[model samples]
Target: MAERYEYLPHHLLRRRVRDVASGAEGELMAVVNENVSDTVVEHWVELAYIRGSSGREFSTSVDNIEPAVAI
Candidate 1:
């Protein structure tokens, strides 16, 4: 049988990533797995950044984020 969900690779954690659709950039904080049904699972990623003195966070599908290019 095929797998229901694929977890993000460990090496990707704490790495910089960019949201493909939004162009937002931040550090990859975590991977979350949600079971939608007996046979269905969804993979998500938490991206975070500090703006001034506060920290901000957002979650999106793992597929929507990619390693950020350093300039």
Candidate 2:
């Protein structure tokens, strides 16, 4: 059986998210699917922070991303 993946909507784009393992926070940029032979094998979430012209960006498994909690 294929695993189900949940994707965020356009309105949720740029929302803040945190990595469950690393505890790093960033803006949710996009969701990517890795396909093999017409089947999706993995799901990834692109994260980044923009400031002027320089910022850090990275991609990780969607399972690691979660909505950032306010404190």
Candidate 3:
């Protein structure tokens, strides 16, 4: 099945693409997907940091790591 684009609003994602790339739309899309993956990982890392700071332990957990799969 095809993926839905609603998870990240198109306009916001478009802006992110502009912020991260200077290339064709197709190329930018690839970059955006990669960016989304990185962003998800970053969020998890940040959570871990927060938990550690609060005297709570947390393992690093990313929603998804596969490039072609949506979380």
lDDT of each: 0.60, 0.57, 0.21
Model 2 — TM-score against the truth? 0.54
Candidate 3 global CA lDDT score:
0.21
Query: What's the TM for model 1?
Result: 0.58
Error of 3 at 12 (Å): 7.5
Better of 2 and 3 by TM-score: 2
Q: Could you estimate the TM-score for every candidate?
A: 0.58, 0.54, 0.15
Instruction: In candidate 2, list every pair of residues with a backbone clash.
Output: none
lDDT of 2 by residue, 1-71 (tens): 34343444444357887777677777777765533234454543333331111267766666677788979
Task: Determine the backbone clash count of candidate 1.
Answer: 0
The positional error of residue 67 in candidate 2, measured at the CA in angstroms, is: 0.5
Model 1, 4-70: lDDT tens per residue? Answer: 4445454567888887767778787777553435444544333333121125777666778778899
Sort all candidates by TM-score, best to worst: 1, 2, 3
Better of 2 and 3 by lDDT: 2
Task: Report the lDDT of model 1 for residue 22.
Answer: 75
Best by lDDT: 1
lDDT tens readout by residue for model 3, 1-71: 22322222222221211111211111112111112243334221211111222344332212211122223
